[model samples]
Target: MIIEEIYQSYLNFLKEFTAFKSISTDPAFATDIANTARWLQDQLAANGFKTEFITGYDNPLVVGSYIVDPKLKTILIYGHYDVQPPYAKASEGQARMIEEDLWKAEGWENDPFVLTEKNGRLVARGAVDNKGQIALHLTTVFELIKQKKLNYNIKFLIEGNEETGSPNLRHFIEDHADLLSCDSVLISDGEIASGHPVIEVGFRGVINTAITLTTSDRDLHSGLYGGSVPNAARELMKLIEKLYQGTTTIAIDDFYDDVIAPTKEELKNHASFPFSIEHHHRVTGTKKLFSENSLDFYTQTGLRPSIEITGFESGYNGVGFKNAVPHTASAKLNIRIVPNQDPKKTVKQFEAFVKNNTPSYATVTLQLGQGCKPIRINPKSELATKAAKLLTQEFNKKVLYKYCAATIPIVIDFKEILGVSQVLLPFGNEDCNMHGANENFEIDLIKKDIGVAWGLLS
Candidate 1:
């Protein structure tokens, strides 16, 4: 069987892939990112893929293709070669020291970056969130080629910008339409919703904005005009609090105008899923839960729209109290939008609401950030159904089909531009610490995930 061989090869590839600090945000890692791309290109070439590097303004995309039978279906596999920024500066040295101490206390058998086999887990960055997935797909194709088992065409588009919101992927896909044309696409960048096998069928869109409130031209001493002058900080807080007052529902007019209700079938499926509210609270370390309505907590987080205040900043944050009316105050907010809701339209409505409600003495400025449309895929596609059956057969577990609250903008672009349905089969755990400190992937999952991908292709 190709399973054992594929597992060993994945380990070898992961060790090398994780060693390169392909941090996308830092210009210092430019060469590292390019090197990672080249390495992936070489692997594709060796596996009989007609491969080339599509050079970007900053990073390069590794594109490869193979044709088996013109009549056979074509599947495009997508993954990223870039990794999130790592903490390596002197200011973070103390934190690293503390982390090392903690790792020791936890009795970690091997180094986090190195491919260490302890008990059963493979400890390393990129082991599960992407590099391992990429390696698995590549190795599966390689094994098929070696055994002459491939019966369909495959195209691989490994990018280096997914960690940075995939800003340039749309242009690259548009420019290379002919190369990426396929009947379907598969993405391995998501996770199992509740640590069980799952096939994510949809993802929520996102809209981020910064709200700034300005009052006086300069700071004013509270003693000089304590009761007369307006405070921008207090005004900003008032505007923000208007989002969720007394209840959890946002007070913005028409905020839920475009939200589509979940179907009866979807609601039934969610109710049958093996989700535990107590487990969720324990895992998140939350003391309480509150919402406008009394619904299943999982339904609210997975299917409902949410608005959050991510950060707030104002005047006079010092060692002691300044007691001043600040000139300006700002808060960063993000909204996870559901399907049928237009981010631009939502932003316009929010702006109008703020303008109409702002007090006469204060001014509110709304700045819109990146936004993406929600995407849903047919759960009954041949590829998805076949993969689901294979996963259940192999793992002896029921696979859950659900939509994720997080956003992946390119999924919509792929559907619109390439006319391809994408399937999300995440092998990582929910608490994999993706995009956070001490991020690590379980080694056992990495091994079994290779088997899962191979089984899907077979």
Candidate 2:
């Protein structure tokens, strides 16, 4: 009956939390982001948490401490308060976003900011990626306190720059190690895999690579000098072609030097999971799945490195294409690295490759964006067992202990700064559309996760 009792209150809290445009990447929402932190500080303080703000960054870090006994093992809850820029700024190298951003994105079941009940799911921005999961923790803690059942000390390090690649996270965690230190960390920021509960062992590391080629000072008439002048877009395309010789391989030297191969046990576990190749294609909207050694879908997703072109900005793309040879062409790429690969080192290799391949007639520059190293917790660790048991029991289904291909960006920082055993307990559905338009979460899963949080922590 705890789920029933907390139902309406849960909805109300999420409703207010989702309304804020706390986009960490946009300085325009700086005030709104500050307000969001204040709101969380107040809420955590109200729940008996000793809260403080770590300011002076693009987004502030909210630290809340709640201690019950000196001898109790303290567990840190890590989550983000910031979100992806809701609306897109096309002029600033953004794809024109639909709606008021996600709110009006087509095919949405309901308003993204206003929680709408569609079947047993709640549709909203930040509904499941992070905000929904954070709400589950808060509610569980609130109930635990009310019932006098808190079993362990809790230290919450809620950040606001995760969506923008957690630019200041390493600095923040290193500075406030004493405040956020804990015996173990529990993060609810992944998707439930295999139609059941999942214990994610690792998330892939990421490095955003940008390539810009300038062939002229300004746009030149394609008709007048099309044959004589070099096309910036063509020059960049040639570089990309050299980067990816095939669909699944990066031609850059030393790209795979640091990749850690999975253990025999890990491979056997992945093979045991009920993964469907067809279903994987359907969910991802891809024509085919690719990996280095023709690994299974799950393994290919989480265990390998990937080079994805996220954005390619160049040329005349407005109404009625102006016949002009583009002078400046740029490409945005995300290189997803697996365990043991150093993100900076990998970027260096990529830089070397680009430098070596640039045509003499064209000038090229490489800009490295945000990147994080991948992290993996031993699936058989005691902490993993404890969290996995609670999650499986809550869902009444088999749990998959797996690796995620995408990077969380914060977990590595947690390990470096807090030096705690990290466990990923994913409560969000796999098809939640997190970070995409029409994001949503199953209300039942949220409630179940709250109950599981209570069972495990309390």
Report the Cα RMSD per candidate. 4.2, 2.4
Most lDDT-accurate candidate: 2
Residue-level lDDT tens digits of model 1 in 1-458: 56777777777878888777677867878998989999988888987889989886358998899988889899998988787654443232244466455444444444445655544655555666577677778888888878777766899988887766677788888888888999889888866756578888788888888899999799999899877888888889988887875655777888888888878888788777786767667656677776546755555666677889977888876455788888899998988888888888888877888888888888788888657877787878888888898778766788998787787777988988998777888777666666654456666666667777877775
Estimate, for each residue in 209-296, the C-alpha lDDT of model 2 and write its tens digit. Answer: 7889998899999999998988899888888888885778888998888887778887898898988877777777788767767787
C-alpha RMSD (angstroms) for model 1? 4.2
Q: Which stretches of candidate 1 lie over 4 Å from their true place?
A: 25-31, 56-58, 69-71, 86-125, 216-234, 290-292, 314-326, 357-365
Tell me the lDDT of model 2 at 203. 89
lDDT of each: 0.77, 0.82
Index of the highest-TM-score prediction: 2
Per-model tally of clashing residue pairs: 1, 1
